[model samples]
Target: MKIHIIGGGNLGSAIAVGLAKNAKGNNITVTRRNIGFIQHLTEYGIVVSQSNTEGISEADLIILAVKPHQVDAVMAEILPHITNKIIASVLSGITLEYLNKKVDGTNTVLRLMPNIAAQFGASATCISARTADLPKANVVTELFNKIGTAVIIDEKLMDAGTVLGACGTAFALRYIRASMQAGIEIGFDAKTALAIAAQTALGATEMLLNQQVHPEQLIDKVTTPQGCTIAGLNEMEHQGFSSSLIKGIKVSLQNIKSE
Candidate 1:
């Protein structure tokens, strides 16, 4: 796959590096108005350019990772160069319908919601495309799975996926930060507190993934009769922990919809 990624910002550059490191045999080019920022990608054999259309004409997959407001301008610059290429967008709030409209319905447009963790090959990417484009979508999914997990979902849910899969990274980190703070108050050093909190969160996630069981089942295992775990959990619940996170997610979805 010859991949050309436009807008070499954080998310775009992360995807470029992730793909370059994990998916071999694919030529990748990343573009930014100021290549100085992402020039380091060359070490991974990725071509870094300042022009969005530099390799777009030859790209099999053109990834749009620009800001939502910049999509039109970027699309205008490269639209003439695109043929039947697969255009995958990682921009939040940009829908497939809008992408199809931009490309004049000439290309296979896919909306992908992936977080910054893509750079470390740990992103949970959600992909959506037209039903008729499932085969191409699956191919893209396979490519992304090399960097992290990728799941195909209905386009209608793409915004929700953005909230959970993309913005959720921040939410998870905030939880870890809170845990670290608690750990510090409990007598651990800052570094040690962070390590414990981060590792504990990772372990919890791994268990859920490996066991494929309900989170409450694992909670039951940890929350023995009148245990500290249950006590803390109850306190957090009483303070609206889950409710706040749920409301935050809903607000994020609403913000995207409003845009």
Candidate 2:
């Protein structure tokens, strides 16, 4: 597949690198516009840092990674050039309707919510199609699966996916910090604390998935009756861990419909 990616920022760069490293038989072409725009990529083979780049046209897939405010300008510049290709975007807050309106084509446009973990092929991705038939969606889904886990969800649920999976990375990091702090209190080194916290989080997620058990059930299994672990867990619950997490998700969801 001939792929062209626009924009070269953090999320974009990560995805680009992820693709670059895995593009065994795939054609990957990234546009950087001009020398002043992405010179860094010149040294790194179409790197996303600042330099001139080829225009859009040779792509079976067009991935847009521009900022929300700048999406219109980019789309307008490339809209007329689009054909029956797939337009995959990671730009937040912009609806699929707005994108299709700006970039006219019989092409299938998809909105994806992916975390930075895409760089490591572990992202929890959510995709929503605009005018794509199952064949195209499946093809696109398979392509992304090379870099992460992909799920085709309802458009209405995409925002919640963004909240819990996309923006939720920051919240997960915060939880890791809290875990590390508690580890420090128990006399562990900072490095060891972080590693243990990270591993524990991974294990917890795996258990939830493999065991197919509710979170409360898992929690009950972990906390023995009248034990120290139970005491600590109870105190944390009393201080509002679950409530706070729910509130954070609600706030993140509100950000989606915000102007």
Candidate 3:
């Protein structure tokens, strides 16, 4: 598949890296105002350009990774050239309806929500489009699956998915940082503390993934009555760990909705 990614910023670069790594023989183009920073992508057979119209004109799939506010300008630049190809927008809070209006409803539009983990081929991406666009949507779903897990969801849930999957990456990292800090306070050096916290987090996540069990089930297994594990868990809860996480996700969704 020929793919053009507009905006070679962080998320766009990550997506290009993941796709280039996993999907050989596919022609990929990444566009930005300054192409020098992402010129290295050419080593993987990906093209780097500063022209949005040129990128859009050359690809079968156009992935818009531009800022939400820049979408209008990009659309205006490319609208005259776009044909019936599928267009996927990674911009947060940009609706399919808005895109369709901008393009005069000629193209099949999709909304994709993926995190920075895309660079590691481990993103949890959400795909959404109108019911009539399912055929093209599935093509996108398969494209994203090359980099990570992809789920088809109602457009209404895109904001919630952004919170839990995109912002959730940062939340998980913050928890690891906190754990590492505590480990350091207990005498471990910074590197060892980071290793311990990161590996522990990976193990915990693997357990949940492989076992297909509720988190509380694993918690019960780890926490015997009056055990240190139980004590620490309770302390975290008391300090509003879970509550704060839930509140944070809610706020993120609210902010997206407001936008």
RMSD (Cα, Å) for all candidates, in order, is 1.3, 2.8, 1.5
Q: What's the C-alpha lDDT at position 8 in model 1?
A: 94
Clashing pairs in 1: none
Q: TM-score of the candidate numbered 1?
A: 0.95
Write model 3 residue lDDT over 40-122, tens digit each, in one string. 98887788999988757667899999899999998888879988978899999899899888877777889999988998888
lDDT of 2 by residue, 1-259 (tens): 8777787666766676666655446665565455364455444354342311354566788888878898877776776776787888888877888877765656678888888887677677888885445667788788778887788888789889899888888999999999999899999999999999999998998899789889889988888889998899888889999899999899879977785
Query: Candidate order by TM-score, highest to lowest?
Result: 1, 3, 2
Flag the better candidate by TM-score, 2 or 3: 3
Compared to the true structure, candidate 3 yields what TM-score? Answer: 0.95
Question: How far in Å is the alpha carbon of 47 misplaced in model 2?
Answer: 6.3
The local lDDT score (0 to 100) that residue 29 gets in candidate 2 is: 57
TM-score, prediction 2 = 0.87
TM for every model, in the order presented, reads: 0.95, 0.87, 0.95
CA displacement after TM-score superposition, residue 176 of candidate 2 (Å): 0.1
- Tens digit of per-residue lDDT, candidate 1, span 3-45: 9999899999999889988888999999988889997999999
